[model samples]
Target: MSFTVAIVGRPNVGKSTLFNRLVGKKLALVDDTPGVTRDRRPGDAKLIDLKFTIIDTAGLEEAGPETLEGRMRAQTEAAVDDADLTLFVVDAKFGLTPLDKTFGELLRRSGKPVVLVANKSEARGSDAGFYDAYTLGLGEPVPISAEHGQGMIDLRDAIVEALGEERAFPEADDEAETNIDVRDSDFAGDADEEAEPEYDETKPLRVAIIGRPNAGKSTLINRFLGEDRLLTGPEAGITRDSISVEWEWRDRTIKMFDTAGMRKKARVQEKLEKLSVADALRSIRFAETVVIVFDATIPFEKQDLQLVDLVLREGRAAVLAFNKWDLVEDTQAVLADLREKTERLLPQARGLRAVPISGQTGYGLDKLMQSIIDTDKVWNKRISTARLNRWLDGVQTQHPPPAVSGRRLKLKYMTQVKARPPAFMVSCTRPDALPESYIRYLINGLRADFDIPGVPIRMHFKAGENPFEGRKKKR
Candidate 1:
């Protein structure tokens, strides 16, 4: 197993910045604001020659067990439990505070190796703070500027010495790239064969859980994991970045992304909030299946409907999840009202699957997962050209295209061009003259006839070539 290091510190001390730097990507959301990271996010980090797993966790804080800060501290403690070493970070520029000493004592009690890091050491007069950090009794502070890439070599050596291995830092000249030999021989036999298409169960299914702030998005994820893998509390907008965790449910690998709850565009004013929202949107676009979480107590808010519409527009397979069902009373009345609203407000996502779940109590989770599997099957549905043309024939016979300027517009042929949000192309006379309503009619017919529900469909019309233009029709 790869060695794991958990970065633990008080709020806003550049822990996430160091994480982003080590991972060589802005994987974690960083802001001047404190307590931005709520979940424990893991990344493959490389420092000089040391490659290992690094976890960026919420900053440690002292609070009552029921408060939001207390929940964040619990998440940090869990990450510490899973780590081979803990990097206790502190701001050298500002000097150590009482909270740092308290956190240091807690880390010491955990019985894990700790490395004290003095961040922002590039600032002048920071040596006093670095010296003071030694009193915490962790070790000599490794002073470095996480923002400017200063003192990394010293930090790398400290980590190597702490791990007690020279393998952590290899010689620069010893590493070489391997080249492959690809000379085909007659003894190799026939090489021209088309491999049969098959599903690879080894690959994890990427699913993004999204909803408005405080809608129990993170809670639902923690429920699925059966552990406090993510921070959850009564606080709104606690989650800032999209954190992915690999999990297995009933023998299937799933990569679940717990994204920051998205607020409406009008309300998202701060730069940090905008970045968080953008990151969430990126998760939705990349995800194979997106579960839109809804608070059953306040179902179908304006932003919720907007997010649903956005998911449909992106052509991603979706399942609507109503969370907090355990607290919901009069389930029949609520479900009936939800159905009416779904039909009225979300006609664009016709036949979408909806599941009622309680993230707190683990109710109806199996059905939620099954809905995702079924929706994915429909999303990847492929239609044979023969079948498409046959369906097109029946559709055109039932409702012929309207005449344009006294000339009948003829739809000649149809064929599926692609799947995964199935797309089709049709060759027709006066394709441009075919009205938008006609296209909608064709799309609707395709959806109903092919049993495509809760997935977007694309249709294209190609004007037919004139028959007499290329031939001498008059003998």
Candidate 2:
């Protein structure tokens, strides 16, 4: 079994920076702003040869049970409880505070092995603060600068000493640790006669939930998790970092991402909010399927439409989640209106799936999950070259490409270049003369004829014959 380490401390102590350093990726959002991380985020960490799971948690604070700060503190405490060892981090440049001492006593009572980490020790006056950490009675402070990558060897030695040499390095297992699953779904396809490989059951699907501020993005994810795994409240922008959580539904592994709520570009002026928005966009790019959450009370706001458009442009499979369904007294009427709006406003994502869900009460969650699964299958659907050419013949017969400069464009051949938001390339006599309207016509035909809906379809027109048609083997 792999050892688990949780970094806990007061706000702005470089816990996230240390986590990014150990993970060798910028997986967590780092800023000078305290309390940027409210939920406990986990990553696979390595130090030289030592490997373990590292959790980055919110800043420890004192607040009432109902306040947001109190909820953040609760998450931090839970991380400490679940960890095998705790890295009690402190700001060496700023020295120890009263809250640090209080949390130190708390960790001592828990009886978990604690490693005091004095962060930002590269600063000129950090020696006094590093020495002050010894007074907390945890242990000798391992002085290190998380930002500059200083004293990492000392940190590794301290961890190995805390966990004995044998416990630190366990036997390696041959089984692969699943991250993102890239297997094709079980959706029936007309592309090829040969059977595709079955879905990999062990791999996990990556789904990103995103929308405008106060759309209940976090609440919806928390409802799916059946716990407050994310920091959520009545606040409009409670989440600033895109946090990913691994889960299982009906024996299928899924990795769900809870992203920060986005707002209009003009309204997003703060540096921190911009960082959060960028992080959310990154999640969309990496996700296999994206769930666009909307406030059912005020569905299809301007920003909400912009978000859906962005998802379609990214060529990602998308589903609309109308959150706060419980607030609507007339469900039937509101759902009908929402469906009409989805069709009219989101023409780019034709035939998009929409589910009415109440994040607060867990209503319609099963249906939402089903919609996500179905949409993912559509996203990964593939079409064979022969089937595509046959479909192209029918589409042209129904509506030929418009004539430009009194000469009709002749589409010679068509083939799907790739799946996962199916992209196609067509070789035609006058590629430049083919109007944008004609391209849309062909894309629409592909969606309706091939059962590929709700995902972006890329169709490129190239002049002359297919590039690979006459290529000969050099070997």
Candidate 3:
């Protein structure tokens, strides 16, 4: 019952920027470009004391259903219909344009509470065209800057007035908004304990390709395959099914899973979209490395960032493909921006290999494919028990996994029990209290010393009581 605020505006009106700001993270892709956002994306939005769901719709453009903009229009219209309140944004610096007016008219007719948001009002004389916004007849304009974080107080007050008293938040029932993201079939059905897995079949390495819808995932797959096997389109949701292709690169055969674009689980309503997300998660279970393809035009969107985060949390290897580099302007400046923002935002994905390429033009595709090969090599890497204990001895001397229950928990031994996910069994007492921070240290050391990349790593604990606690040991 939480009132939803749909940020509806024409292309490049700062809707995604505001969405990211409200979400308190750089979840949406923002650039000095127009029409970069396409899907009707919803996220946890906040404005000081106000916490509500915010929907960032694609730019509304004048086009027919056959065109991309027209499809975007359908998504935007659907978002408007689903929301309880709406914010009609306009580029105040560019002055009110016809598209803004058309968007305003559309919102005005919807009978939902509307707030006129005039964005980019931070610079001097920026509001010179504020008067033009009045013609939309949505009421007094809320001049705000999403990038500079200006006028948030006013925006918050306006949001509270619009929907604060309407109803309670719908998500209040769910204690935790489970952030379940990427899934692939390969990640599923791997709990076989007795049957020895064919190392040859499983050792080829598993890779999952994922990102927001229309983030060039299919194009990248096609480029790697050297054929037009997968369907590609500019519209979102072109590839509704996850397809697996078995191929080899330099005698190293690998299983590549091309999955549908993954978004927040709560926002997925369409049947096809749900199936795609489920399949992506399955892939993640088995994929050693997940290559996230992002549209250079709107790279690092909320869904994109979430997808990467899910991989790291699941302890999988990660790579990022900034696809469509050919369409991005000012490559140098953009890379610098990406470095700064990505460092501050995606801390979990620090040190992740990012490759800029155009899947359509084949620019930098070879490098991307090679990087994948190298990362897979790292992913399958293993270390001897002697080398691990040696490294562990050095680490323990430097700093040990502190004491709990006054016992000073000891890590007696460790060994690489399996590959694929690159799992290890640690022989240690009091396994339940092993702090997560210590686990991270062990993971970091393993990755650094063994040089693994883009694969999930599992660390198992075996208490030293006995191989059989109640039963007698082997006679």
Instruction: State TM-scores per candidate.
Output: 0.88, 0.93, 0.52
lDDT of candidate 2 over 1-475, digit per residue (tens):
3799999999999999999999999988899988888889999998888889999999999999899899999989888888989999999999999999999999888887899999999999999999999999998999999999998999999998988888898776747544544644423243544343444445578999999888998888888888878888987898988999988999998989999989999999999999999999999988888999998999888998999999988888899999999999989989899999999988997999999999999999999998988887777766667888898898889898888889889898887766677778899987887888888888888888999888888888889846687799789
Per-residue accuracy of model 1 over 1-475 as CA lDDT, tens digit each: 2478999999999999999988899989989999888788999898987877899999888898798888888888889988888899999999999999999998878787788899999999998998999999888889999999998888888887777684454444432423233322212222222331343445457799999999998888888998878877777998888999888987988888999999889999998999899899989887888999999999899999999999888878889999999988899999998988887888786788999999999999999998988887777666767777788888889998999999999888887665556677899997889999988898888778888888878788998777678776676
How many pairs of residues in model 1 come into backbone collision? 0
lDDT of 2: 0.88
Instruction: Write down the lDDT of every candidate, Cα atoms only.
Output: 0.85, 0.88, 0.74
RMSD per candidate (Å) reads: 5.8, 4.3, 16.1
In angstroms, the error of model 1 at 342 is: 1.9
Clashes of each: 0, 2, 22
Q: Give the TM-score of candidate 1.
A: 0.88
Q: Give the per-residue Cα lDDT of candidate 2 at 66.
A: 96
**1 against 3, candidate with superior TM-score:** 1
In candidate 3, what are the lDDT values of residues 16-56, reduced to their tens digit?
88998888875455655676566565677767756677887
